[model samples]
Target: MSVDAKARYAQSHEYARLEGDLVIVGISDHAQDELGDIVFIELKEVGKKLERGQVFGTIESVKAASDLYMPLSGSIEAVNDDLQADPALVNREPYGNGWLIKVKPNNAKDMEALLEAKAYASMVGEE
Candidate 1:
């Protein structure tokens, strides 16, 4: 979970990138790497509201199926439907094409509590 100051992360390993009122959501690179080959992706529908830390979707990998947590509260504005056919985008570009959803933050103030990149590195250290 190599978080940058520009990004915020959850204990469950989901990440948030705040932009204006929108926050991009994705799983960390470490989580995807650990999951190995992803086989399927189920994403939250657009317009759906989610609270921070809520289970929003599921990622299925050769290793196992795991829940995806919302890193911040907001309404889902978009989902990367491309992932349904190509889940490896997560492995290929965890921070870019791999992003799972885009949301509008309901409480920007809470965003400050997420882990900084250095802290996240330390949190998932030496693995």
Candidate 2:
């Protein structure tokens, strides 16, 4: 299980990383590993606005389906269409090409309220 040192984490296992003006969102490496092989992903449409902690989408794997939560309040700027065709990218490159969404946060400062990498790692017992 890998924790992104540059990303902030929610207790629910989602991660938020700032990249320029957009915040990139995705399930953590530990999450993908726990979920087993991913088969499908359903994400909200671009431009949808959601509050922090809102259900943004769902990810289905061979083991089970899990609801994805918003780590920050934001408008959906982009969804990773690549996952529709190759969901295992999540298992292979969770923090890279497998990232789930790009959000335009309502308040970038909200990221400060999330867990740091070391804290998140400890929460998941990866520390």
Candidate 3:
């Protein structure tokens, strides 16, 4: 269960990392691990607006399928097209090449409401 020190986490297991004006979003490493080998992902179109905690997408693994939630209110800027070709990237590098979406946040301060790496680790019992 690896946690990215620079990222904030939602209780549902999505992670958000601010980069310039965009926030990168993805499932936590623990989430990918628990889901086993990922086979598919369905994400919303770029430019769609979503509120925090709203379902933005879905990920399907050999073990099960799960909804992907928005960690902050934002408009989708980009979707990782690589995942469609190799969904296993999520299991290999959840915080890097496995990232799901890039969002232009409506309020950057919304990130402060999310759990830090340490808190998230503790919440998931990785601490």
Query: Each prediction's TM-score against the native?
Result: 0.93, 0.98, 0.98
Query: Which model, 1 or 3, shows the larger TM-score?
Result: 3
Error of 1 at 80 (Å): 0.7
| 38-73: candidate 1 lDDT, tens digit per residue | 889998789999888788999999989999988878
Candidate 1 ranges beyond 4 A from true positions = 1-5
- Candidates ranked by lDDT, best first? 3, 2, 1
**Model 1 C-alpha lDDT versus the unseen true structure:** 0.85
lDDT of 3 by residue, 6-118 (tens): 99999999999999999999999999999999999999999999999999999999988899999999999999999999999999999999999999999999999999999
Pairs of colliding residues, candidate 2: none
**Residue 118 displacement (Å), model 3:** 0.2
Quantify all predictions' global Cα lDDT against the true fold. Answer: 0.85, 0.96, 0.97
